[model samples]
Target chain A: MVTGPRTLAQVSEGDLLAEIFPYFAAHDGLLIGPGDDAAVIATGGSVVATTDAMVRGRDWVDEWSTAADVATKAFTQNVADVAAMGAVPTSLLVTLVADPQTPVQWAVDFACTLGRLAQESSVAVAGGDLSSAPTGTLMVSVTALGDLGGRRPVLRSGAAPGDTVAVCGTLGRSAAGLALLQQDLGALAEVDGLRAECVAHHLRPVAPVEAGPAAAGAGATSMLDLSDGLLRDGDRIARASGVRIALDSELLRPDTDVLAQVVGGAEALECVLAGGEEHSLLATFAGALPDGWRPLGRVEVGEGVTLDGSPQAPRGWDHFAG
Target chain B: MVTGPRTLAQVSEGDLLAEIFPYFAAHDGLLIGPGDDAAVIATGGSVVATTDAMVRGRDWVDEWSTAADVATKAFTQNVADVAAMGAVPTSLLVTLVADPQTPVQWAVDFACTLGRLAQESSVAVAGGDLSSAPTGTLMVSVTALGDLGGRRPVLRSGAAPGDTVAVCGTLGRSAAGLALLQQDLGALAEVDGLRAECVAHHLRPVAPVEAGPAAAGAGATSMLDLSDGLLRDGDRIARASGVRIALDSELLRPDTDVLAQVVGGAEALECVLAGGEEHSLLATFAGALPDGWRPLGRVEVGEGVTLDGSPQAPRGWDHFAG
Candidate 1:
């Protein structure tokens, strides 16, 4: 018989599933939910799908991040990919591979946070898989499915010359927060509100999920999530669309100023331009911008991304690069 | 500039993507493919979704399975989940988390084999993610989406008393093969045809993927994939449907006989009853059985599964159970 605080090895798969299933509430879109071989969902004519994974030690360290924090980041990253395609995220399928010795509390915390966030966003936690991994390893993978709602998907290759580039969420807060944490200033959050907020942003990013469909509805020609930094992700649109994205340094001052308060002026500017995992919506529009969107720059007949008149090299997170 | 047979750490993410993207061919169902943040696919009124993952050391050993073998098993497992729901699998999203020092050829081999199989199956390779893992860890997760074609999903809880229980594919070959391999008879294939077939079955098990929807169309009341052995998975249907699955030992003789050629009679019987990873379709029908399906038992008003009027204990693979 299992006693108090039993590890996963001591618990049966059925028992663990019984514990995890209750966290996911049913929704109208889910025709068939968990407990089956596959989940059936009512989808639009076209469905948008993407998968992303986060591994412990590489994507996050247990010393600085909680299970809830990992869950939040994993959820945001995948949903943001669907949002980047100008679609409404409707359902998610999560997969967790963990060592048998992993604490039951960790899985419970992750599921509770993911379910709560998914429900709040009106996205159903349709189904998921659980498997045992090697010792000391824990990884989570999420596949987000979205509905296009009859709108044409906004691709990264749709930007054209003379289009106004805009952004809909915070830029450098996450990166600035990482900087603070690296300096062992996490304890400073109790004394400084701004520092705490930065740390929180870095740990749990909230993507402007609705802004994706909104930008499409407002005639945005091209869009993507600001995941791999502003400069690097922006350059993707520029190269794919065969145009140049020219950003005005003055236009980014507002975002840079917010980071400057914590990380100083030069470092803030760098963070705003080069920080990854922001999960913000970056898009280009030929017409008027959507509400809550701030203009950043414009598309020009050139190549790559530029700041003012100078071309900038693409630099951001690369999983394989040394 | 990266050259030669370099490790993943020696190549940039962009170079790796560029190398892998060409392997995936575009399909009409895939409106948006891998180049974008998310893939867009055409679906029926309802879509079936499921996710499954396999870890390196836990699920496979490098000496026993090649990268291509792993890819095939991963693809089959996810697609089998969709098939179990009586849906036509249409698209897949894959994710790989590996150490940076992993050989580039492993990734290339996996992608090439997966793309080839997906094309042959008429399933589109939609989109995927790649991330770095801790040292000595490798994992792959796949999310398969299927079209229901306007049919009601055949759920696990729909079987009633007097239903005919049947199976649509091979049963104990996979487990028999694993036994032969475990006994170091994998290299004895040249001397014995049956041993070779068993080895092949264990290495790459294939499911009758198209038979699922056909069974549903023929009035199957309940259906699921035989992934975790016959007795254990049969018990699941029995518990979920609140009926007893009574198997006739005489009806299972053919499958047992086939396995008996490689292994002894008693061992073959054990494999037929308790072997896992078969990926075959098991269902109960209230009407005429579909083609390629053979009768195995009957659903009776009771609890759990039985064989020859005797209660059988549920035993199969449990990822977390000690």
Candidate 2:
């Protein structure tokens, strides 16, 4: 019966868990869920695992993002990692470390949205941990587990010279959205449809989570999620495979054109090339492209990434970079 | 090569990762390690997944712990959760979120110690994420995946009346160690072996990890890790299983006696009853006990926990309680 901007400090851990547990629906793969020491999930012969964390102030500002927005972004980031390996995301273990004085509503909103998104994505909500943090701090971390479904993982080191590089889903939208938020141009959303879309994309970016396995089925040689911009992630594949990723700006015009409507044309183009957190699928295929995929570049015998025959500097979001 | 007390801000993400990557050794279960969007690990028919997070200033003070100590404690906590489910830990995905000004040596020390500990524990370092946090914030989260190895998971709600309650590892040592550290008696470690051991236990408590699967093999009805103290965790099993846990303090003398050498007898007795972060295996069995396990009590026809025929209050760390 506690109400009126109640903080976590006023509630018991058991009571909070009881309120949060019902948000996650049961899944067949989850042999056991929360309430136990750990969760058990049915798995294939091989499992794909990855973890990602987001901290307040560094990853998101409360003024610009809600609890739901934070939850959505965290879910997408981890799911996209599993998807990039050509695996179907099966479950997630989430951890929340927040100050005890944090509003209970924030945790409730995050859990509800995350549970809903997990259902929509057909992933199970596994066990998790909750710990108190120092004052004014809030952080969320997610570990996504996936089933490979008997296919060989599409590794970043598998691409060859003749592979056709392609991308599925939107790029630069998140970065453009961030820019708009930074400039306090979010009001543009009230009058402009594209600007609103950009703002929405920045707050909660959606990834083509299923496109990864489709690309693998279509004979993808190498694949990854575009998390740290197209250039940086593309360079990862290039360096891992010991080849060059040569991009054709003409092929990227559609993305830049879409972004240009929200930001300026030049900035839009730059966002498309170097903006991070897009969560789009980037893959190199040996044969024909899969449905919904568009050509972006080609693999060649060289090192690093090139744009229109010129070497491009590896510039993107590096958390520790000066 | 960079030297001196260089901070993370001075290094590129790629270069930092290159420096940290060499610490982890390859394992057979890891199909892919860090450097990819996600790592692939060989799995059995089922996987046990759990996550835990530790925040600086809340979980531990820098004056009492180093990065290596924090890494060890974090790893043990996650692995103990998996072990509590009657599974063998196979791999871990770790995430580090810290301020950019955090020293590079801290990150290196953490990675190296985690790598060594993972090797000792036979767990693979699959992959992880690194992100910058707000000023003065430092957090670490770990998600551990374990193989069930064809055994049914021992749940917390499976204990029945007449089940024998037993513990597989030392209790109260961690709590006693915390008491010593709080009293500034850590310096007594130079003159007392028991005090040194208690201090070490508090800094990096090791759980009886293998005893979990062994207990399952020995027909354990229910089990859990003792992270939140005996009385509180025992109350959890009682509530979950709809039964009562009746403990005999006489059987607990071995634990209290060992703790008495470090902290006085009366305090040691209280520590054995209500101390947290023990990480020992607590189980109920319908059959004979395993070799390393010592009997403590039994399950009865009621709810909650009792000590020597008296109802015991559930007092322990709640993380959010005022």
Candidate 3:
């Protein structure tokens, strides 16, 4: 159970970082990772890494997302990127900039939240920078480090035609939560489960940590995370692997149950297809399906993605695209 | 030579980061460090790392510091921290936030300057994140990675009473340059050599990159960079090593000519003894002095740092203390 203050809002980020980090002891292999001035990781084998940045007005909010929530969201999002490569997360290096008006306590609490999440994910915060910003924006950039663990990393470019396409983890809950937040819809507040789901999904996404290792163990050829929407991310894999992807709507029916009443069946399908930031593991398996596998699509001989063997209707999220 | 279209005042920060990062070419060791949605650095034995952030307005500015100047300052400052422990800098990950109203090209030029410096130092900007912030502020945070090269890292500890103290690189130039900046003294501008020192020392701090490995090779008992003034930093080494340090002012007489005009001999000595951010390497060695060692002081049996065998005045920069 999560313990500490009654609400995360009360604790500052720096204090939180100081609190949870000491609980997780360092390993011998972690020669330079975490605590002291910086954290170092053993990287003799192979290290897979990626970096992502989040800003205050553009990324999250104090009114809706707490410091802890923002920290959790950032940590998991980076974790998902490493997991997509069929690698286990090993370390995280963070950089933060605050304004003069920022409470040092809040900064500390945010760091603690980040540390706790990293500890839980078996990743170390390692090292980071702190400074004052001229503006009010709170900027956070996180570097995610992963170890290949002696296996060949599954890249975005190895999917072969006739391979099974599958995904693991929830989708569209974050978008739905955002929509609800945008609309200021509080009616769902009474239901603990629904409210918790909305908030948790948006604040702290749980990426399929085990799925990547399992897929690697099962001999997956190519993989990626559904960060930019299933259709869009699938297209990336397709293009990289030089294969076409065909999705079956029947298998996606499971998503309709939660989203149909809110946005209608068609829109629900579109969100499930094109809504981004789900952080679900989307991969192509070359051989027989594993026991727990629930397939939603298949790779074909063509060079693009299709819905039920036809061109899909919706486009995906493009940060620079208007 | 630096080349670009936009002036520092005319460009925004996000666009700047996007423009300048393309110049860097990633190596095989950097599996995921900078682009393609994330970054990674291979850990060959173990790794040493740290992160520090700087904010425009809070740290420096175009009105005073040039973009190239600020870029160099940021790099040298962080590199010094990693170098303090006898670690060799291998890569850097930078994250920046700027306003839309800010000049985009200025930031781009800044990135170019940063990239050039990274290349010069044999370090690459491996990965980073760019985001938008409010007006008038530029926030930059850097995470530095270093390779120990299998040598036992000479930490701040391990200094014994009989160890000899030595410094690699120049001292008091940065402090002199800072004085010139603060006083707006054009008088020093007439002195050709002094003017150069004022400009170069303030704009680009030259860190003792080779000194780390050299000290490690020479059987240094303890080592640290002279970032937080010689006297103050010596105190840190003293506290960490649980020994006293005595500085010989006679060895510093050669520096008086440079400072005789701006600040008297006493004040010049004070700056060299207590000024911060020079980035020179201050290290202690056991037994006989190494050839080419420029002796500045000696480690003694008691605690505290002494100037001419007396307790030195308390002078050092503290982030929290006013």
Candidate 4:
């Protein structure tokens, strides 16, 4: 009849945990890791904590993404928040809530990918929970904790007038990739160069993990992850700091020019201004721009965001608003 | 037609967050609270971390529980695990994934209850994530972080053959209450005293949060939270410590006898043996039993758990087994 426990329903939670525990290694300076009531890790006086979740249908579909891709996205989304706090991510606690009918292999693949990514980043998979869900439902969430080695947290309220607005990672890539997929599902197999890269970024975008602490060390006035769009996220900084963010089209050309070749001239500008999930670091500096960061705008004495002296509405991803 | 955001989809994520943010107070020694990418909290030299999640259909039914009930249960379940680790819970990161049609009042009620609980326990509500789920789906998860205060974590493997097994909280009340509700959904309002208490416990379980650090201070050799029934969790300690746990039926009468008044004798025994979600602290002590803890059994030179020299099968909640 049955050779092994194939579906999650066929195995006990302990059996599944036993199969997945080996993928995660202990965090640096961890007193305990997994397989216990809880895990323990050394924190440098204070810890930076954040969480993110991805649901099936809402976050991704099986057709465009794999388990590894899901793991990468969840990992980056969480670690990006930690980095945006100007902290070094030290550990993660992941939860997988899925239906009993899900294949056991999917959990294994997700764990393997997450563990490898943690190891590469030197972050620890400390602890997590697993629960069975209703039919046709599978979700994953991550809680990332980071260490701040005595640096003051760079808050969104610190952007003063005359500060330079900058970003350290790609812009509009994930949104453009989503557009490409909407245009053609087979864009990955057909398209090459920037288009393929965009699709890949949409599926599993990379975050400039190290640039966060670098910006903090370089005296960043304000910072945040570009999770929504430039205008929407910029408005957050503007509202918090009580200053306006004035963007120059000439400065965004480095990103828009490249995306134009893949999509179009007009669409590229829209993507660069209103696209989401880029996972890029957006910050403001009072002095010299730090390494790897390019200036895109400036902080002014007004409110909201402006593009070439015109007020633009903030347009991007908002979970419930959509 | 609507005065404010009635349903989640009626408002943006920011507007909803602005409504809920005031419910949480900044934690003691918290450098930064919500309204940022992450929250920063001061910790001891080390931090104890654990996560637990509850799904809508599988973990609860909306007909039987309210949003406040869900928050209380989730809080107790997670803090109980941290208490079991012999640490003081310092902060929590919560995530709520709900369908767009879910009412905003539900979220507000949950935050209110959770914030009150955190304030009572002196734990900070650090930060969290919110995402919209598909139709008819809702879930909540909590990640609790604790401070050890320089004490070594009491591991399950530390039990010796001569140690005394003990528990510091109520037993089988939640399961017995479930039985009452299953027998008659009207048992809660129709019944009073112990029966109503059982039903209330089943709806909102409370753990002996203080006894964990007390047990650790009193030199507990092994410890764990009794979420999944006594027999199954006892077997875990037996397997981990490589010693047999010989439970005393005479000692169990205090629990079974109390539950038998609510349920029948046999059902009470079964409930005491295999009830899940009790949120009690179970431990092994080499010296004298700590205050608030009563002896349940003794560790013996064998494997598995036994009741009065008779082996008992490990039976309890296994998330995917059903």
Candidate 5:
């Protein structure tokens, strides 16, 4: 009971909520905030909604990632999905289901980072639930709501045979970072520059959020965020559109070349082709590429994704497929 | 891979999604459904959003609840929150974080029940996330989004002095059911009629979802769903509205009377007073009681909740208070 350190079990839910609720102040268009049973947000015409959850050991380990890192990843993943729909991120409902033994400080830190990031993005921190979990459990789930701003949602089925495949953010950096981490703890101290950037991207990846609406405005045929991998997510567009995505190795040099310096040639190619959690915007455009986007491939009359005309199976995170 | 009984770890994410996505057929206002980065839904005015998450062991036990029961409770709790905000439930984003070793049948059955319930309620099962969790972890979260239909949100902070307190549904039934479960296994079979109803209500409690908008339409001053229990939740409305909720034990006879026969007098009073998870609509009406609502108390120019002029403290589920 001494205030040296406190577990959630030592505090009331109302007390903890009162402490964190201040971080999520009222934002524009938020009619009601966190006090009520539900939050009221004024939407334009359409709302883009998505949810993403992360488990403690599954998503990130405590040794490598902090509460802020977890919050960043969870928040980014949800809003990136909203952005991929060509919608501006508006609000987030965050659910924290932690073990009673978990420290209150961890939750407070997570809420602080989540609130700060949401505010920086001009997103409202809407209310969510808190519940106790089994011992040793700590998980966070974020449901992000977005405003479409009168744009028709760009679907994966809209890509045509003649469309150009383009991406607006880093490729394989997250995977490369994971590889570094997995390869050795020595990499953490010895790595620098691009290698360090890769590790950072893996822990708290950032997406080209603005480029999503920009691509939509520039007449994107189909779009999605690269949460899985280039091959897997690209194959999603291909399968959905009933067309093949043909990627040129020459076109992918800009990314692979940079990654090769950090993780070597073969691994760099693999990372570029099949890395997960990139959070980049991948879209098919019938016209010229958008400002922040670079051409990656082309949609052809076939099926699935191809690298230099060779088929590539999905090689990324599959929730059930351990 | 002989398909007798399969674990989630045996299947790919897309394969599982493919099998379950059909359950969520498009609704009228759904611009886009699952399979994309985000689901796009059309809204008329303000959107009322609420989220609730349940852990496997904490919220329910495998010995007492099936996957269908969990789905029902999760869906009900979320929609109940949205309805309590004076809005019509429109769509839901469900996140399932489960152990990879969990059976595929559990996920499928959950989705089937969830999709069916959403359809029955005219709610779209828009899109959500599925991720593997640590061993023994199985959690489900639901974020329900609703349309305000041009009506102002009926907040808990709107109750003024001299308002009549009314409730539209059952009280203490869920907690009574929980008590029965925790007390005796013999109660399940030996108790047939009303006692069985209590147990069933605890497993999958139903809400008077329609009464929410109707109360708002009737110009009710304030309202909320009895989630954490009448006493605890009533205190919420009182503290928010800066008024006292004065209860009349005589008027609550209808609920306590029926409960008394099922669980006895002393316990029945406890259940009616502090029982939790009763998804009933409680409101303070400045005018006449609505069609389905029954008067139970009054709003006075004070603070907290009082029973027969005696002060009562908040008692019910507190997630971190284990």
Candidate 6:
């Protein structure tokens, strides 16, 4: 509807967006401005940047995903990207596309959640664009910036032979929790705090922010976050590193304590091996492990991946899998 | 499709990511190092930023939107955002998530497209992320940075009563073309100049790179791009300036000529009034117009919008409108 008492029923999407931007006029870092084609922010030197977008049906639930949840999800997910690269998130920019009739408060709530999360994450809500869509789904695109206080970036292309692979933070709990949630296994909820574990793994993921710097300072050879399953993510390194990687399944058994009761040792092993969204820091060390690092594998000069020094088959999620 | 021959699949995304940092061994203005949870960029003084994202079906076609198109759209859209704010595009960071089965070449093409677009826009593809998603939909998010020199940015909040409203660059073409594409009308071939208009407005939208600085230099008070329709966008200035916006309508006829043959005069007028994505600079100035800036309207201290001094109902796009 047009603003200021013009409640026309069938308004164009552009008019709606034209109405939304004036609300953001109070932002200070909005150095440029909005309601133009884009918005601009002031930066210092090297801007730490990352972006993530959430599709309604794909990334979250319209039923369970509140406006706040959707906003928080978009912010945190992009924040995690910067964190994965061992950067300090400083500011956030959001692009929200929602259908007409989406309660105005929904947009406000979304921005408020983003603001709260940004503050909590030590970042500020910088700027954004708001547009109207023709569909029921809401799409939120988030861009996060980091302040990389003059350090070499941690990329995903430096592991070498003899580099010991180590990790910091929990793993596979999200996948297991998701499985439980999807299966509605309410009766099997008693295995080693499984319900809480599942919820913890699913609801809010805390990325290993400190581990990135710790590993970087400790002379890490390479690094990345585990957004995908371990088995698949490991392969990313192996290919990028142009080396053969090997892991000991036995090493992951200790971390499977929470899953031991529900799925037994074998399934727990699979969780550690194939489950994902752990957001843990995985790094290859050329020397001694960092303080909290646990060595789980090693890099070798060759090709492909091996389990217990033997070739293992690849098993994980595939988007196009039929 | 978990790569690396086998064994490396067990290494973990974290450990693998940790191994890739040393490759980012270049760069001068690098302030903060990666690995501290987030990266920091020291902007020295000037920094410009913008964000844009592409959701699968909403923004582009999955089958027709090649990885290159996807990448270009992501980069160009963000670049346009920064440019629209009167800043020179500088650097970009991208984040992507898709099914693992997405051909590696698709990723490569996307990257190359991003790089090429950045080059065309005088920006650099500085950083990015790649991840796996269960469902196959390409989600491309890009955040762009720009250098603002020292010009005070033109905002949408400074238009004063009596300020002449003018636009720089073509308008109505994109929206008209969009309508044609949606209708799947092959009439673009039949209508004189419709095909070029449709394709020009659809594929590669050229933002007014020179006009932004010109407007800034010309001391434009309140400025913005005509991303949405003119009548609707004009209302934005009216609301922000607390003034009534009056459009001559006849003055805007020149810009709508391309749509006349297919849409006729009335429909074409509507398209020019509310069609978006033209990316033409619209600014309100206190005095005489510049050489290329055609006068379309004026701001007056009053209420609502008027066409040629008479109250006119707004028929522009509304995101939430049914």
Candidates' lDDT values, in order? 0.91, 0.91, 0.71, 0.91, 0.91, 0.65
Clashing pairs in 5: none
lDDT for A84 in candidate 1 is 89
* lDDT tens per residue, model 1, A123-147: 8899989999989999999999999
Error of 4 at B268 (Å): 0.8
CAPRI-style grade of the A/B interface in model 2: high
Better of 3 and 5 by lDDT: 5
Clashing pairs in 2: none
Give the lDDT of residue A221 in candidate 3.
84
The predicted structure with the larger TM-score, 3 or 5, is 5
Q: Each prediction's DockQ?
A: 0.88, 0.87, 0.39, 0.85, 0.89, 0.31
- How far out, in Å, is residue A21 in model 4? 0.9
lDDT for each residue of candidate 2 in B249-289, tens digit (9 for 90 to 100)? 99999989888877889999889989999999999999899
TM per model?
Answer: 0.98, 0.98, 0.85, 0.98, 0.98, 0.77
How well is each residue in B150-238 modelled by candidate 4, as lDDT tens digits? 89998788899999999998889999888877788534545468888888888899999999999999999999999999999999899
Per-residue alpha-carbon lDDT of candidate 6 for residues A204-311, written as tens digits (9 for 90 to 100): 566767677667767787777776677777776777779877887666666777676655667777777777666777878899998877888889988666878887
For residue B137, model 2's alpha carbon misses the true position, in angstroms, by: 0.9
In the range B21-50, model 6's lDDT, one tens digit per residue, is 332343333343433333445464556676
lDDT (tens digit, per residue) of candidate 5 on B62-118: 888899999999998988898898999999999999998889899999999999999
DockQ order, best first, reads 5, 1, 2, 4, 3, 6
The candidate maximizing DockQ is 5
Candidate 5 lDDT score at position A175:
93
Winner by DockQ between candidate 4 and candidate 3: 4
Candidate 3: which docking quality band? acceptable
List residue ranges in candidate 3 displaced over 4 A: A1-24, A32-38, A135-137, A190-192, A242-246, A262-267, A289-294, A300-305, A308-322, B1-21, B31-34, B186-191, B263-267, B288-293, B312-314, B320-322
Candidate 5, DockQ score (0 to 1): 0.89
Native contact fraction, candidates in order: 0.91, 0.91, 0.48, 0.84, 0.91, 0.47
